[model samples]
Target: MSAAGPSLIEFVAKRPWLKKALTPLASWYGNAAGYRQLGLRADDLIPEDNERNLQALSRLPPKEAYDRIYRIRRATQLSLQQKILPRNEWTKPEEDTPYLSPIIERLAAEEKERDQLDTLGVLKKH
Candidate 1:
């Protein structure tokens, strides 16, 4: 963090290839004792309370540098078609990459079906 906002580590700014390995940490440090006591799972994205910095940081991205951002953006776009999500509200563990597609598809399908039923004539008993 600096006068402007959370500055990207020099590693990220200088080395494009390192993007694959970089992860965005929600906090500045993890206290191992506290972490062990709390049993923290690693993959988490805190909501950006400082939305201005988030907006600025968006432009600095080597686009796919943050998988969570990429996934969230995709989900938001898909939600427009399916109506399954609010714009910024992403699934917990939003970067659970291997399972995200299936989860999104299932939810979106359910939402679409519900919307369809709302438009179509109702079922009496069946």
Candidate 2:
């Protein structure tokens, strides 16, 4: 599972050739998505309204959470001003890492586990 439902990340990773082929395109898409231009990481684009995302946001380390908020507020300010960060100030490829996603994935896994446990029922025979 990913932030966007079922993920093929593991499957793609297991295929070296396919992963290699896709890596550049993925990078290109990430850059083209435009969040980085606003000095925001990929994770900053995730909506904060959902349960899993809210849980993930809460679980982030204090400094990391603070940084995330700063980035978002800055981006919002930039957006309202109809401006983007200067080229050098744009989020670099290496800096656009998945800070929130791993936590979200973990939360999703925990929810799945809890649901599985809650569904347990004793057998009854008539």
Candidate closest to the true structure, highest TM-score: 2
Specify the highest-lDDT model's number: 2
Check candidate 2 and list the clashing pairs: none
The ten-residue window of minimal lDDT in model 1 covers 32-41
Separately for all candidates shown, the number of backbone clashes (residues 3 or more apart, or on different chains) is 0, 0
Tens-digit lDDT track for model 1 on 81-101? 654434245333443333222
Off by over 4 Å in 2: 122-126
lDDT of 2 by residue, 8-93 (tens): 88999999999999999999998898899999998888998888899899999999999999999999999999999999999999
Reference-based TM-score, model 2 = 0.88
Candidate 2 CA-lDDT value: 0.91
Provide the overall lDDT of each model, using Cα atoms, as 2-decimal numbers. Answer: 0.44, 0.91
